[model samples]
Target: MRTVHPTVRLAVVELRETSGPAGDSVGASTSTRGVKSTQPSRPTQRPTATQSPMDQFMPKSMSVPKQGQIDSALAKMIAIDFQTFSIVEDRGFRNYSNSLNSMYTIPSRKTLSKSLIPQLYESTQASVRERVQKATAVCLTTDCWTSRVTTSYMSVTCHFIEDFSMSSCLLDCFEFSDIHTSENLAEELLRVAREWQVDGKVVCCVSDNAANITKAMNIFKWTHYPCLAHKINLIVRDALKGMKPTVDKVKAAVEYFHRSTVGAEKLKFTQRQMGKPELRHKQDCTTRWISTFYMWKWFLESKDAIISTLAIVNAPVDALTQEEWGVEERGVQSPGTF
Candidate 1:
C-alpha cells in the first residue's frame, strides 16, 4: 500500500542484507534499497507549435531576417545571372552561406531561372532603353556565325556616347533563317536598328571583310569599317605560308611530345639539367594568329632543351631536324611580330 514517485518507478533498485535487531543477531534480513532523492525531477522542455526547430539551435540575440530582405538578396543574385545549377550546386557558394548562418535557405535553380531572372531582366532592359534613347549617335557592329548545330545567328552590338563617355551594349542576337545573301543581311540589320529605335541615330556599321557583309553595308548605305584585327590576321597568315614546312616540323615535334608521356618527361628532365624552367610546347590555333606566334615563341625559348630531350628519348625521324630547328628559330624572331 506504498506510493512511489513516477521517476522512481523508472530507476533500478538493489537488494542487500541487514542484521537482525536485538534478539537474533545471527539471522539476517534482506531489503530493497535505492539512493535517496532530495528534489522532484522536471520534464525536459520542447519547442512549441509557434517555435521552429532551427530557433532552438540559434543564439537568442540573432533573429531571422524579414522576408523582404531575403527577396532583395535573391534579386541581386539573379541580376548576376550565373549558371542556374551553379547557384544551387557549387560547393564554394554553399560554403559561403554556411559561414553566414545555418538558418538561411538558398533558392533552387528552377526558382532562380524561371521567376527571378525574367523579373530582373525586364527591370534592367527598361533602364538601358531610357539611357540609350538620350544618346546623340550610336554606332553598330554586326556579325554572323553558325553554331555547331548549323543554326545561323546574327549579333548586333551598339556603341554610343552617353553623358560624354563612350558606352557599348549588345542590342540583340537573333536567329537568321533567311538566305545569307547581302540583301537579306541588310534587311535584318535595319530591322534590329528600328526595333531599338536607333535607326536614324546609327551613323556607322563595322564588320569583318566578308564579301557578303561588305556588300550588305553598301546596300544599306551606312558607312562601314572593316575590322582591323581581321586585316592583321590576314597579313600574318599570308606571310607565314612560305614557312609551312618548318612550321609543320615543329608542330609534329610538339604533338609527339604531348602524346608520349615518356617524351614529355624527358623534356622536363633536360630542362632541369640545363637550369631552365620546364616549358610545354603550344599548338597553333587555326583561327588565332597570336596562338601561332606563341607556339613558335615557346619552341624558340625551349629549342636547346627540346633537342637534348629528343636525343634522350630517341625520337623518330619525323622529329625536327637540325636545319628545321634553325629555320623555326629565325622565322619566329623576325620583325613581323604578331
Candidate 2:
C-alpha cells in the first residue's frame, strides 16, 4: 500500500470539509492552492448614522495665536501713550476697529495685560541689555519722588557712548515702598546694577544733593556728582530769601489778577490798547527757582498794561513802586547769569 504525505492529507481534509463531502473537482482545488496574496487583508468598517462623510479630511480645531506683529504694535502704543489696559474694552474703539477690518480681532485687555505687554517689555529689555553689555563704561542718573496719589517711586537712567555716538535708555522705574534710607537706596542700586550685569562698569552716578542720596552714593562706593541745576537752584533760593517781601507783593498782584475775571479781562483789554499781545502772568513755583525768574520777567514785560489795568479796576493790592520794578528787573537778570 502507498502511504499518503501529512501535508497532502491535511489539504484534502480541509477541501472535503469546505465542500461538505461532495467536494469540487481536483482542477478547482489545484487553482485555489499554492498561491499567497501580496496585500494584507484589513477588516472593513461602516460609517455610523451620526458620522459625516467629510470628517476624515478636516482638522479638529484652530491653533491659538502667539505674539503677532499687530499685538506687539498695540502693546507699544498703550505703553508709549500711558493708556490704561481697559481702553481696549471701549465700545467706540472696538467699533472703529471692526469697521476697518471685520476679519481681524482685537485681543482682550486681560491678554494684553497678562501676555503681550509683558512679552514686549521682555524683548525690549533684552535688546537694551545687549547694547549695554557692549558698552565699556556707563553713567547713571537716579531720582525719587512721590506721585500725585502720594505713592513713592524711583527711576534710573543709563547713558553711554558707542561708536562715538551717545546712547541712553531707562533702566528702571519702580514703586519704592521702603523708607529711603542710605542702606535701602544702596541695596536697590546694587540690585539693579547686578541685574543688568553693569555693576562693575558703572563709572559715576548723578543725583540731586539730598542727604539720603549723597549718603547712598558713599555707601554704594561709586563716584558721585551733584546736578549743577539743582546746585544753582539752591543758591538762587538762598539769595532770594532777603527779597521775600518784594517777591510776595508781586505774587499777590498775580493772584489778584488771576482770581478776578473782571481784572483779567481788563488786563487783556489794556494789552490790546497798548499794541501788545495778550500774555498772561505766570505764577512762580516754590520748587522750581527758574519759575521765579519767569514770574519777574512777565511782571516787567506787562508792567505798563498791568499799571493801566490796576488803575481802572481799583485794584486792592499795593502797586509796585519804581524801586520795586528796578529790583524785579535785577532779579530777572540774576537767574540768567547762572
lDDT (tens digit, per residue) of candidate 2 on 1-338: 12654222121111121222344422232225677544433333333334324643443332345336667888999999999999889999889877865545788999999998999899999999999999999999999999899999998889999889999989999999999998999889888889888899999999999999899999868999999988988998888888888899899989998899999999999999999999978998876898888888888899999988988889998888788888888767775552
The per-residue C-alpha lDDT of model 2 at residue 316 equals 94
The global C-alpha lDDT for each of the candidates, from Candidate 1 onward, is 0.77, 0.83
- Stretches off by above 4 angstroms in model 2 are 1-67, 95-102, 255-276, 304-318, 330-338
Candidate 1 minimal-lDDT segment of 10 residues: 5-14
Off by over 4 Å in 1: 1-81, 90-92, 101-103, 146-152, 175-179, 255-266, 308-317
Per-residue accuracy of model 1 over 62-173 as CA lDDT, tens digit each: 2446544664576676466654545666788878976876556666777767776677778788888888788879999999988889999999999999777889888889
- By lDDT, the best candidate is 2
Clashing pairs in 1: none
The TM-score values for the models, in the order shown, are: 0.69, 0.68
| RMSD (Å) per prediction | 12.5, 16.7
Score candidate 1 by TM-score against the native. 0.69
